[model samples]
Target chain A: MIWLTWRQHRKQALFTLIALAVVAAVMVPTGLAMHHRYERSGLAACLADLGDAQMIRQSEAAVHCQALSHQFQQQYSDLAFVAILFVILPVFVGLFFGAPLVAREVEQGTHRLVWTQSVSRRRWALTKFGLVGGVTVVLAVLYAVGVSWWFGPLVTASSGRMGYLSFDVQGVAPVGYTLFAVALGVFAGTLWRKVLPAMGAALVGFAAVRLTVETLARPRYMSPKTLTFSPQSVLRPNPATGDWVYGQGVRDAAGHLVASGAQIGPCAPPGCGGVAAGSYNWQLYQPGSRFWEFQAIETGIFLALTVLLVALAIRRLRDIA
Target chain B: MTTNDQGAHTMELALETGALGKRYGRAWALRDCSLHLPAGRVAALVGPNGAGKTTLLHLAVGLLRPDAGQVRVFGRDPRDDTSVLAEIGFVAQDTPLYRDFTAVDLIRMGGKLNRRWDAPLARDRLASLGIPPDRPVGRLSGGQRAQVALALALAKRPRLLLLDEPIASLDPLARREFMQALMGAVAESGTTVLLSSHLLADLERACDYLIVLQTARVQLVGAVDDLLAQHRTLVGPRSTDTGTPRGVVSVVRARHTDRQSTLLVRRDDDAVIDPAWIEHDVTLEDLVLAYLAEADTRATRTAWEVTA
Candidate 1:
């Protein structure tokens, strides 16, 4: 069964490997050059510590360090653009590799041929999904690791790899995304029994769930920690260093919320809130130190969802006839 | 181990179904399709399109689960018993093979999937037929592809083989050759075969047992020689339209004109015929058509009674 699965999917595997190789060809040279320039261009000097935690505020060369950071950003802007395209790999995996996995067999009427063999339908379905899905995720993890390494110097030199811009490509999340996408494709394929429609459904479904997770569920994975301040004696506040600021609001003297985020207009009722009432400005953020925790949470959510889809696909396969 | 009075060695039942049924939404693909297929006999499942032939074969192979009843192959359910799957090889409708797989690839796949795969038998058979083992099946002609499918099934060395319309798409010469290869292989292994086909001539020569299905049910099933002997066509004056003729077990079909009537009847007893009538042996095709037409009319009569 294992050998047969390889024979069936070796073409798709080869194409993916070649695509990975091409991406490597592009990332390797630029990544090496970017590393060479990280220290030589003095972007490292802008950070207060090796952690890229805070800017060297008291130094006279702070202005010079900002200039170096801006220069490095401009020089590597092309690589940054490519780095953002990394998520599209999982989408392709969903559409091409996963969508057609069982769908093409049913469409071509070949399920009747193979299911009549000595293997039980359950064994055949599980083996195919297991092999194809296992390889797809392993390759995705390797790609994610490569991208993380390539982006290491750049992210650590900026915001310590905790920002949304670098979080998705640098951790175990890619494996989850790839796995979920493939399993979603398999489920769609089994449900629809046609390859093209399954691919379309998988793409739309993957995008919708990914967007919903990223925008709606992600910020609240853990409750945002809050920082509050009085308006009159506002000090240069450094909350958790390099924290992701989620939202900001103002509270009145009595601690009733008056305005929030970017929706604040001048207080209509003249003394309802603001500096006149000693209202404090409050900011919400996920501390940068919880980066690994966030990655594990997101990956676990996607993994649970992937397992559900795989189970549904297997159940659907029994009724295919 | 039970035997008839003759005490000859009795073959076991290779396949059996009891009140087997399958439905697709509102329509019944197969209804109460209980069957008994004894080992060591090649049976033909004769039915027109939409007559549930494929449904029966699919249920037998466990590709389909019965909605109302159960199917047992060698006294074990195909769906629950994976070991029974090794003993039942099937070639599905149109002989669906992986289009991109070469014969060698498929042969290798068969070797991996089946415990009793005869690799050299598959290879030698294809080689003897001048088939190139390395060419993709999609590139092969219809005849060549069907041959490859047969080879794959035969290599499994199954005790029973179920084929659904495997030769339906082949030309005359290819159809004959396909059956010849199938018969030759089955003869060597003494495998029980239940083949479903609309082409009566092909099945007539290859099969010894016959099962005719109509309206999603089995219309008639028996050994070929017995079926041929048990049915007869009688021609007489139209006056007999009052009811069925004497000694007929049942009226299969009746056609009447101004002065004459023709009737197909089933009878196991030897009875005297009136001098006014003449009897003739019914051909297999006529026997099938009579039962089919009779079933259609019976269905209409039942439907009309409810409305009336």
Candidate 2:
């Protein structure tokens, strides 16, 4: 079974390996160069001294910190945009490998050939799911590790790693995304029993699940903590620490709501001073310290989805004919 | 026949079914299909298109679960007792091999998939046929691909082999060659075979047992010789109104002209024929066509009856 699976998917495996190598080739050089710049600019101390009022006020080491940070962001911003392409890699893997895994056999009528052999349908499906699913997860883990390492200097230079796109590519979360995408593809393929339609479903279904999860479910995983500031400050957590500031708005002196974040601008039918006199700026954010917590939470959610989709696909195998 | 006594239930049947049925959504693809084929018979499942031949083969091989009745191979349910699966080799319609795989790769796949594969037999067959072992099956000629598929199935060394319209799309030469390769290997193994085709002639040369299906129902099933012996053709004057013979069971077909009547009828062994009637033997092709024609007329007449 292992050899058959390997023989069938050897081409896909080769391409996957090549893709991984290409990603590595791009990552290693850029990562080394970025790390070199970060060290040479002495921004490591600036990172450590973030959010400290005394260091900002008295430390001479922080004199060139602002200029160096701006320079780093300017130099590496293009590379960060290139990393966006990595996000779609899972979608392609899901479409090509997972969607066609079972559907192609049924489409080509090879299932009848194999199912009539010494192997049972359940065993055939199990072995395929085990090998392909296992290898995909393993590859995804390696990919996530590499991307995290490569994105290290970028994260340190900007808003840590807890921000939206940063959080997507870093840590164990991408592994969960990869698993979910592949499982979704397999489940769709099994249900549809056709390669092209299953691929379309996988792509559309994956996008729907990911978009809904990131937009609706992720922010609600833990309630946002509230912070109040005097009328002078912008009321967002300092971007230097990479805290995810969810919302910023004005509140009355008595803590009654006055205006939501963007509504405070361009005063309409009234002077802005009317509300500013009594309202204090309040912000909603998740602390940067919760990075791993969020990663664990998101990964756990996607992993659970992966397991559910796989189990459904396996159960559907009995009803193929 | 001197039977070897092993146990009380010593049936020699390789494939048997009891009123098996299947449906797709609301419409029946096959229904009321009953077959009892003894071991070592090369049976032909013959019918028109959409006559449920493929459905019956699929049901017997566990590719489809019967909606209504039982399908047993060697006295065991194939789906329930999947050990029976290893003994059944099936080549589905168009002989679907992985188009991207080489002939060698397919042989390797067969070896890995079946416990009783004859790997050397497969290799020898393909090599002797001058098939390029490393070329993808899709790139091969239709004849070569069909031969490769036959070799793969034959390599399994199965007790029961089911083939579904395997040579339907092939050219005449390719079709004959495919059958030759199949028969040569099958003769050595003595496998119980059920090969299906809508055209009777395609399977008539290879099959000894006949099962006729029309409109998702089995019209006739028996050994070729038995069916031949049970049916007869009679011609008599059209004006004669004498009662039918006692031993004749049913009228399979009938035609009348101004002066004479021709009747294709099924009968018991001893049917007393009127002296005015002339009796003749039925050819296999005529026998099959007569039965098929009878059903087509009845179906058309019934459709009109419903509207009327």
Could you tell me which residue pairs clash in candidate 2?
Answer: A159-A242
Stretches of candidate 2 exceeding 4 Å from the true structure: A51-67, A231-238, A257-279, B1-11, B239-246, B301-308
- Give the range of the ten consecutive residues with the poorest summed lDDT in model 2 chain A: A52-61
Output the TM-score of candidate 2: 0.91
- Quality of model 1 by C-alpha lDDT: 0.83
lDDT of 1 at A151: 92
| Model 1: how far residue B113 lies from native, Å | 0.7
Model 2 CAPRI quality: medium
Error of 2 at B303 (Å): 4.4
lDDT of 1 by residue, B13-132 (tens): 888889999999999988988777888889999988899999999888988889999998988898846688889888988888989899999999998888888999999999999998
lDDT of each: 0.83, 0.82
Q: How many residue pairs clash in each candidate at the backbone level? A: 0, 1
Q: All predictions: root-mean-square deviation over Cα?
A: 4.1, 4.3
lDDT of 2 by residue, B79-125 (tens): 84568988888888888888999998998988788778899999999
Top candidate, metric DockQ? 1
